[model samples]
Target chain A: MSAPVVELVGLTRTFPGPPPVHALDGVDLVVRAGEYVSVVGPSGSGKSTLLHVLGLLDRPTGGDYLLDGVPTSTTSERHRARLRGGRIGFVFQQFHLLPHRSVLDNVLLATLYSGVPRAERVDRARAALERVGLDHRVDAAPTTLSGGERQRVAVARAVVTGPSLLLADEPTGNLDSVSSAAVMDLFDELHASGLTLVVITHDPVVSARAQRRVRISDGLLAEL
Target chain B: MRRRAAPVALEDVLELAEAETPPPPPPPRRRRWWGRPWRRGDGFDLRDLLAEGVASVGARPGRLALTMLGTVLGIASLVVTVGLAQTAAGQVGRQFDAVAATQVVVRPGSVLTQSGEERATGRLPWDAEERVERLAGVEDAGALAAVDLGGAPVTAVPVNDPSAPAAVSPPVVAASPGLLDAVRGRVVTGRSFDAGHDARADRVVVLGARAAERLGVGRVDRQPTVFLGEVPYTVIGVVDGVQRRTDLLDAVLVPLGTARADLGLAAPEELQVRIEVGAGPLVARQAPVALDPGSDDAFDVEAPPERSRAREAVQADLNATFLALGAVALLVGGLGIANVTLLSVLERRGEIGLRRAVGATRRQVAGQFLVESVVLGLLGGVVGASLGVLVVVGVSVVQAWTPVLDLPTAFGSALLGGLIGLVAGAYPAVKAATVEPITALRGGV
Candidate 1:
């Protein structure tokens, strides 16, 4: 197998409270290059917390996370943010698209913080939109798009920076069956072309599409 | 074909991504001199910060206008108060220059006698007018004295009616030929007595406008004569429009030599000198000395209290009073901007969180909001400055006075608005910068 794009060793996340809550307990995982991995869990199963730690949005209390061979546990917050922008991409269930912006602008904004050159941002955004099969909707506003189309635009924004790892949290939880299949087909096409993807969901049908599946429950993970 | 096309596009994007990756940091030897590494190509630049700020501010027009109102009023009032103060000071100085600023009066020095009565210590020289006229800055000089005509009732008719309802008698004043010119009085009708009249002691009298009206002598062309005591004097002229020494408009004036001979006037009591404006102090000092060269204490002089100093004092007083009021208004305006900007921060918390998530640093986020507030303040300042100029000009037009305003003051006031906005927006910008990215994620989820 190629070098691992993500390595988690003894990662633990604890939230401070009167009685502290452990969101991730001794989680260990590895996502190799060009791999499509699915994390399956129910509500409050620490799936989101694990995703947060993997995306460098939240720091783990103990142990190390190596993203693209760089140890991220001891990096500064600014360095982590830079890594998050240039190397990692996130797709949330709600899409998180700015309604007032044009579809093309939504994708171009991802390049603003990812070190993309100003002259090439438009071309990169257009190429990313074409890859998502939404090239015709570049001039349309996000508010004018359907739920599936908006999700496609969000995916385009996520991939516009050409991130090393793409993280999706319930990407199809709000979509219809037809739209869910369409997005899954897009993911399969991405994985076929050597992109690393980690999709978190509770639906077995969605998890089954991935080459590797991991089940998470009550802050612990078991590979299936 | 589709599978091959996907991989080729992915290879292109991956190649670009690899090329764009930042180089590894230099090996640690000593601590880096700069606190933050220069991330020039990575994060936000000045252009991006400004564009984001402008876009955010332009998103809401109504709120922007409401926030700017306070700054506008504050800046407008400040400009108006300062402009009007300068204009009014100029107007007052001009009016003062016309009359009071150009006059100097010299009177005989007095002493207490052994019997406890005030007596003139020294008499004015007989050629007092000619003596003082030679002094520099003395435009015109005249000698004057009140003639004591021993119970003689001066009247228009020669009939000495004892029971004619006790008519009030007009007083007689002895004056040199230059008195009318010195006092800035104009001859309303007829002519004034000349030097020849004084040399010949011709007994020609000039009637003040009020005195002529009381004596019922309107036309001097017919050679009207008025009786001073028992001697008849021809009324040669009626003098009016006396700017200085307005009391001269209500007296009957006779030639100084004629008063000395016929009315037995002892000595001239006072000298009136009309100097050029702003020459009061110099003329006052020199006139007293010129009147009595041997005795410095022979005369008391009163000059218009230092014209420029008095004008500056008045201007300073006006500026202080109005500027304080304008500052208070400006402070209130700044507070208003702060209040509204804070509200905007609170309202846009989610948006701010989203920006933070999308790779904007805390400084970048703060900078965006700061730029927004500054733009608002600057706009208000420009509008406010224009409004203030208009107000000053309008008031000047209504009052028929010249409007005075400094260009830099107007320009600086607008810049002050931008500065106020910066100060006002600081706390709110900090608050925005502190918003966590997790808020955006949690909110979306």
Candidate 2:
């Protein structure tokens, strides 16, 4: 269905040095539409590199990447950016929320690069916040939010554009156990609503919630 | 009346097949020159850029204000210099019109003979005033002679007291009776010599204000006598304020006939003519002809230029000096902007990385920083221009001058500040844009 939302074949990324570090080496992965998948690994296991490559933030040194059956390996930077803006959403471990912006404005910022029409951006952003259970705190600044609420706002921002695939890297890494559990529950609800989700984490509790699990070690991948 | 309603059918309510037609595609949106068509769902909005730019500027108000000081000083100096130059030019013009412009000097030309001796080629006739006065624009005319006394030093006191300070020999000049009016001289005390004194060659003399002070003869009522190379002449008047020949305020003036008769003075050396307003050119042209019809070429007439050329040259030099100073100030301001902007780029690496990760293009990141710098410069420009104009007005008011300011100078300074900001922002914006997202996310190199 939907030609499998994402497919990677023999993807490889290397950091140059006297002895180059192969952060991701010949990794192949595929996720069908609406699937909830977790890529789990310990530190220095290339989980972050895989997530970066998938989100189009970092280029793969070798491999083929397809999103919705469209080849992206040879796409120009401008085209890649357009695809990232319209078709993919990312959540970072740091939340990366702008301190100066209100919770609503942060959500609205998703439409800033997505080309959402000015008239509909506010309503769409509001609806996303509502889905993340943050409608009551729309006008509050991000500094005022608890860790759980901030992460939730970040989630709303990621989904505001209705991106086809959501990529989260260490989504619960900085949150308390209770807040992390709450954020994981929110992820489950979003997945149940038929949105494709990929989470990269070393935490067993976070990985256990995914419908399918994949393990990464020494730049290689295996299914569990 | 009975109305029969059609039975509501679930199939009729569901018209799902008709609903498949996508409601007339959301009204077409406009495209920005820089952005892709809105329907592409991939273009950033201009408003978004502006919002981010404003947010960044507001984030560091104190730093922004400090950075703005440089531009303000630069623009302020430029505007003030231009404004004052205009006002000073206006004052110089009025002074020129009042004195030099209305007065023309006509002097006899000398030719070097084959014998290697200088001889007067054309001498003003004894009736020079009458001839020149006949011209249409001549308001007043008079002849003057230096009346050389053969280098003989004359003193106020007849007794050669060796104990007295060294004798001062002020030059003696002889003038026609109407010279006072032609030269715009005012009688400070007593009276000037009349036609009777000139016709009879009377020994009456008018002491210039400075000359009277030099001779220690302050009052004409006392009838003090000044010995001009051993001939005593009665002091009839003390004159001051000679507008045309200000240097003559230090000379002793006697009747022309008296000087020629007693002091052995030759023919008059110069003809002084005052004309009606705007008659300088006409009188300058016709006066030489009126004085010597055949030897008109032998006389040289000096007329004021139409627009105060000498004063304008002085004004230009003043403006150049002040503008150079302004340029230095502006240069310093531009450097300040560059320094602060570079620092901002370094401090905001985290923000830059975040924006990049959120799908902003490199150009967009560069554009945001550029806009912020430009906004800073524009703000400084506005404040500086306003302050500069106010300073100009304030100084003019204190100096009793009319303020002069043009529109372009006022607005152009602001534009110049903006331009400076633009140039200053270039290196920093490039640095901000080139920071790799992965490195910036790690918060360091």
Candidate 3:
């Protein structure tokens, strides 16, 4: 690879109180272009913490975070959010589509946040929904969709912006095996379509689908 | 299939966005709707703000609708009350101005007996006119003598027709030319009093419009004859109408001298006086005493200037009353707005937090609330203004009154309504702006 898409050096996060609690300690990491990588750990091992920092949802307590080449550690909240909305697409363990919105509208919301023109959002949303085989379910409620379909809708929302990085915080965490395979298969298809995918899960079966696996323990990351 | 890789990270997007940013910056923020219109900024654009705000709020339609209702009603109430009060004030000013301004009346008689016997005389002597005319403070003074229709047995017979209905004129001194000036009449016929005519108590007369028209007496120089107490009188000029019902315009303006002789009203029924220029105090005291129209009272002194002053005082009092009523309406509007804002703040705790998390400053949040409040006030003002105008115009059309739509009054009412909304919205909007997002999102009120 010409250069890594993301590089984090000596990243540490500490929340202040009577005695400071360290959420992440002295971490160095690199994510190459279009690579499907999984970070898996038990609770409190900082897998989600690392994802938050990488996704621009939060700044590291101490670190140099270089994206492509420029720095994000010192950027304003506005810039950080702009970057997050434009570049990084996040999929939560829970399908977090706003409850009141239709599935198509939910997909359009991502486009709206990314600053698409008002009239273009619907067509873009439709095209995104079709990519996940949900074109016919355009006006359906997010709540009405089954576990697998809802997860797919969430995935559709994530990739709608054509974001380079797709962070999946346990894509099939809430699904049964049958539904899990459906979600995993969709991720495989997206990976083939040139999206850099990061799946965070403690499931060994989930980890097995990734091209490379990284284990996090006690705020430390190890390649497996 | 080849394993694809290339994470679109933050740096890549920022680089792209920096390059894509328009050079001239989208028409320089396109005129901010709130405060400073079209001032240059380092990217704090109201258009962008509105777009983001609408999207964020639109995400929750039920809550937004409920909040909008509260604001709209608050603003509307403000506008309507203010507009109505102003319309009423204008109506009062126009009608009252036509009649008098700060006016007072001075009737002459005290309460007296009705039996034909000359009881305790409730009278101002007809000759007392000289005394009133000479008063140093009095300006624009004139004396008028009246003849009671009840006491007279007069008949009118037009020369050409010879048998028309008797003109209902009692007989009056049409006095000096000053009498015409005193009651605001103009001689549209031959001429008014010359010295000789007034001094000799000439038997020449002027007919009021109705009397002249009825008697077929349109001539200016040809001497028309009318009988009064069996004596014949010559006609002189004509005027429009009687100013007071008790005093007849339809009556003749016989020379003041001739009227005294012809009517035998040496002891007059009432006296008319107008105070001197700027003699407000004298005239002011004169009117209430006069023009009372009741027999129990002494002779009523009808002082024009005083009556006008009293009318102005009455109008002022009415204006104050309307202002107080308007104030009460404003209070109600304010309370309603406050109640709504408080409820909105409480209901929208989570949403406020979300906007803050999305990068809105405290000022921006508070400002959004204020803008919403102002919009409510303006909307209400628009609706209320339309209703008020309709009422004013409708009244004018149906009742034959003129409408005076004063801009200051209209704007004043609207501004007051806006003030009510702003005051009511302030604390709640601030409280909403300052709410911490983490806890609000975690649990809502």
Candidate 4:
């Protein structure tokens, strides 16, 4: 791939404190098209911060990061959010679905800032849920769903946008072994279908499953 | 080989692209702004939320009813108060306009006089008022002197027949042209006293129509004369009828000179003083019509009209007391509306947060909430005004009074309701505007 999907150079992030916590330190990384990369780190190793920055949820303290061959350091917050919505999909371990809404509604909320038409929302939501094999539970309240099923619903919400990148943050952290394997298989299938997938996890199994693994400790990525 | 060879190149490529990855369906057919104005197209769609919002409220009608009830009662009270006060003001204006300040009265003393008791004081004669006119700044003056018909019951002998109606003692008042504009009884049957009649001491008298009927008189155009203690006084004109204002009827009107001659008195009949240009009377005379010495209840030598106004003032005080109580209800209602609006702001914080997160500015949120509150208050005003009218009708029906509603009363009360809304909603709306979106979305009060 002549133009990498992601490129980060000399990334440094520091928090204000008595002893300023260095969340990220001079990290350099790259991923080409259709690559499945997993990042692993111990506690306080800046795993989530790295994921949030990649997902455009937070402004970087210092970095030269390019997305789709375009420099992201100069991008405005609004542009970042649009790019995040249109070009990158997110999967969080906690699901974070609104409990008051139905499964259909929770998935539809992901599409709110994307400017979808109001008329076709219901049908579209139903179709998204069907893809995750929960079409029968379209109107079921989110609090009623099983853990694995809820994670699948979250996955459905993420992939409904058909973005070029899939950013999963500890995707299987809340699942048991069997459910974890099932989700991993789904990730494998998506990768085979040519999505650029990034999974942030400490799971050795997930690390082994990805075609590439990037390990970090104390805010620096180790060359392996 | 299996597929038809027709358009094979284009068809196969299109199918392959679709199988690999689908394009984004041309950005979801960009909807017209009115059709889908909001950018977040997937919001609880109007249909979903409208039904759901209503359902959310309907799920507990008891609470909803209580909320709405507070608004309803507040509005009703305001409307009723405004309407009743309007009616009272209207009736008083009409009555005042019909028989306005006609003449001035002068007694032996000033209003605050500590002289001899009012009953012993003398009434200014008809000629005395004419004398005052000669003083600088004095204008045309007349006298319409009166004595109580209810006091010292006297003998009455009918002019046409002595035994007619057995007996009737009408309230006798001696008046001249000055009283014409003051009484509802205008001369309809005969002509008024011209200068010739007064100078000649013609004794031509104008009878009130009711008194004329009582005396069995012919059409007064011929100008007949009747005996006052067997002293014949000519009939000059007859008025339609005198007003029965608080049981005082102006039944007999005679020129001052004629009355003086008839009574054989050196002093003139009661005097009426007039200032040059509508200035209220400076001095007045009152002979306590019904009082002895050392009494606070002594009747005054005030102009009959002035005394009537005093009576009106007392009635007005009573009216004001009721009106003030009504206003209190309105004020309480206004406060209730404000309180409810505040509670609504707090309760709907989540909804406000959601709207803000979707790009609503703080002003828009405040404006929407305020508009809702005002609309609520104004609706209450309309109802309250109606209740006010109802109150007027009830009072009049029960007391035989013609209470009324007027333009200013209506306008004032309606505006008062709006003012209440503005006053009450101000702080709450500010509080709502100060709310932070992120904090509200976090749902921590």
Candidate 5:
């Protein structure tokens, strides 16, 4: 009976040029509560553009994006950012952890711009690290961690805010097969605990782990 | 039985309901994750920004030190320059205070008292020096008059030779007995004419150093004699270091009685008085009264400045010149900050992208850079001011002067450094804020 966690209709994004390339054209998608969906596509198939629009990092030229039952097209950039920090979380392929901070500080960084209270931020960060099996590495720097452990730290940072939706862009692209499997298993654990997930990857093995899969080619989408 | 059952049922039913209730669905938006209300604009804490500023500044110690050098030089030079100007001014003031301030000159002036006819003027009495010497602060007093020795030129040799270049014509002056002490003159060789010589109307003279030279007289041991228009006078002494009436150094001095009896000298024209420090005004007002009780208005007294206005004037001029130089140096320091900040923004594109992606607004990004620059400037200002004060004290110690520095000027320079940093960082912070997140994520241009 609750509204869908994410809804996009007629989404269009264009890059201004002499030829005027359309990165996304009339894409429609719906993700309900607690669902795990994987968007699979080739290198130039507009997946990044779609992710950018969904993450509120870039606005679509024409479309409707409803996040948590609230239309985000008309919101100010500040309000959109608020929604991004409050309702959604991102895990990038590069892990993007600040090198100067400790693993624990890296996780706590998510609460810096989320309005989290000062007293409880460290405790919440610690609990999130424990969830991702990184409690032992709390004081260690991100540079000291292996690829798999670093990816796990990134996941902890993403879910530290208890967001309604988690978006992972190429989560296992830079990992070995074993590390990839470990990261996927961690995502499975997060999903089993009633968290919504959307993974964007070109790897078939990564897509196969999701409950449902969608494919995109040349800015158009098709259910698989 | 029914009443007892009802009372038992109330407690048991409450306990059963408490156990059956499912914990309320994880409280939504208002209490997201942290279980507290989310207030708008509370995302970034000032403390965090300050911490971030510290971390960024601490990252490259060498670069921070190098950037601070400009401001250090700017502030240090400013303090030293101002301090030295004041010290040098004080040094010049002391010299003036010794001679100009301690000596007072009184001369006769003609006054028209609203009458059509102009009165001749109050002549300095023959005993003017004795009368003025009675005043409290008068250290010594003397009088001098020009003798009208009819048109004949003075010469050391009475017999003129045709080959002589020209006849020397030094004027002759009638001086009182106390002229030596009042004028602070030191007789290099022979003794000066005393009261005994003046009482007997002796034809004695004291040759000034220059006059003695002009007359080919070097030593008073030979009792050199020079002729005043064929009236032979004995040179009793040769005096040097006569500060006031330096023109008298080139003239011959004769006793007042000798000039009066031989050259028809009527009365003294000028009176000179030497007083203690801080007594010029008092002596100036009392000298005329002592000389002629009721005719005080007829004498004009020349006194040095009451306060060291000349020193202040010199200091103000020096301050204006040096402060301009300091401003230029400070401006250069500001530009150095701007240059470093811009380069930092270019180098930290990845960090900027990450922060922007993590919901840091443009203003927040700009604020971080601004705070970093201000911290850099403040550090430089504080260190520079301390070092400047040390340099001033050191120079003062070496020069044997008391160090002078305005505390407010020192503190204002420190704050000005911060202001310079703020202004300098403005453009760079804006440039950093305008960086596109996606482009910056690509690791710069």
Candidate 6:
């Protein structure tokens, strides 16, 4: 119903070897604006490779990826980086946060490369942290926070740039049940407010929270 | 759609909606044949780059200090060695100036006779001292000659002991009053014969210190007398420190007029002129012409080489030896910086990868590391320069020599550290720029 934020057509990724391995094979998918999509797959099911291609971190061998109406498959590295910084947000399972920096500083780092204005970066980072329900802990270091709090800080960093699409790779794989539900509730609130999200996970319960689910296996995808 | 039961804040929704709308894209332009389309404000601001660099460099203080030690020692040693060389050379030059650099000797030119025998061509004027002293930079000038007593057996005692073993006779020398000053010799006892004695042709002599000792004359207060070929001369004084013409110490010196009147002496053979240091060549050239204006080559003059030339030669030698040592230390310092920077790159691969993922261009990533190393080098340079100055001053103070340090050289050495850092950081910065975001994020090589 809405404008497509992510479009994948005939996406293929093959690693060069004595016998080449195709990690992504003829994958086709569309994530519309304001949609919450979950990609479910088992180990060695090409999930990581697909996520990488979708995140614009890896180049697809043969395909067209249209991010926000821009054909990005043929774009230069600089242009892709610009798009990745200003248009896309990523959340990895490890919650890559600088342990030495404060929560506010970690969130502010995302704005540094995303073309955020110098005068407004701090205010924007604070606002993003508040939205994640961690306004009281903006000055705390990541190492001092629990696993769930660190994940929340990572989320704040991801959304600080107001990316058009948010990509999460196993956002709750390391979290307890209580924290997982809380993170899912936060995602639901974000999706209800018209933010597009694509979450990759292996858990059935996690995938069930999304409006649309796609299972990936052997380098191909089937909608469920 | 599966809706969540939790309520969402209206402001949160509004903020998300507002942020979701991306900044307006630039108007499309004609595609260039080479390179990508130019984007406005694409890279980092200089202020932000510097801030990030400082933060990262300050993150590990212990490692930073350890890495800077090599550069510190390199620059400090370079400055110290060069400074000490200059200071020590100055000390040696001063001693040289006092003696060798200040003295000039002139002698009558020799001519070949019909029989192929060498004979003196021209004689020095009787008033050679007065004539040469008028020249600028001439401190003292005098005339002297070895007098032939015609087989005279000179003795301190009136009678010669012919029955005893034959004793060697001390030669007699006739010198003008200015000779003592020219030779830079000081009288050890009583007084030297003055111009009055020369004018009156007085039979007075200043014995050399060793000659006085040989003659058993301890003090001139008793008015000791020595006989030169049956002529008696009063021992007015004894000279000890003969800086130039050291042979004067053993000779019995008498008044020039007295030698000509009593001993039938001819014109003086040689003239000794003590010029100011650094004025050797000027005085040497003018002294020969001043002695005999009729002929430029009337006298052969020997002056020490130019003071600056000798000083420069010594300085050059010192520079060559010390600079090699400094260069080796500097090279080691550069290698240390490179090795540490490379190790830092490898250790922080994840951080570099994350920076790349955050839309940092390869150049920006490299710039950060470059700035870090340059700052390290600059800091080391400052510290090393200060230390070098302190050591040079300390050594100079201890050795009681004047410390000579070129300020520009010290400042330039500090900047050289920055240059070394630049060269040392190049490879590591390139390596850091090459890190791929995907592999880095996946925690692979």
* Candidate 6 steric clashes: 0
Worst 10 residues of 3 chain A by lDDT: A112-121
Best by TM-score: 6
Docking class for candidate 4: incorrect
> How big an interface RMSD has model 1?
11.2
Ranking by TM-score: 6, 1, 2, 5, 3, 4
- Writing each residue's lDDT as its tens digit, candidate 5 over B6-82 gives 97899899889978997676533322332233454346779878877777787679889998888888887877787
Ranking by lDDT: 6, 1, 2, 5, 3, 4
Per-residue lDDT over A106-165 for candidate 2, one digit per residue giving the tens place of the 0 to 100 score: 887778777778877888888888878888999998889998999999898888777778
Computed on C-alphas against the true complex, the DockQ of each candidate is: 0.19, 0.21, 0.06, 0.10, 0.18, 0.21
Model 4, B362-406: lDDT tens digits are 664565556555555655565565665677678778867776556
Chain A TM-score values, per prediction: 0.98, 0.97, 0.96, 0.92, 0.98, 0.98
TM-score, cand. 6: 0.83
* Between candidates 1 and 3, the TM-score winner: 1
Which is the winner by lDDT between candidate 3 and candidate 4? 3
lDDT winner, 1 or 5: 1
**lDDT by residue (tens digit), candidate 2, B206-302:** 9889988998998878898988878888999999989888767889899998987898877888989888767888888898899989978888899
Which is the better candidate, 1 or 6, if ranked by DockQ? 6
Q: Give the residue spans of candidate 3 off by over 4 A.
A: A100-102, A113-120, A140-150, A170-179, B1-73, B90-98, B101-174, B177-199, B203-445
TM-score of each: 0.79, 0.79, 0.59, 0.53, 0.76, 0.83
Candidate 3 C-alpha error for residue A176, in Å: 4.9
Name the better of 1 and 5 by DockQ.
1
Which window of 10 residues has the lowest lDDT sum in candidate 4 chain B? B28-37
For candidate 5, give the lDDT: 0.83
**Higher-lDDT candidate among 3 and 5?**
5
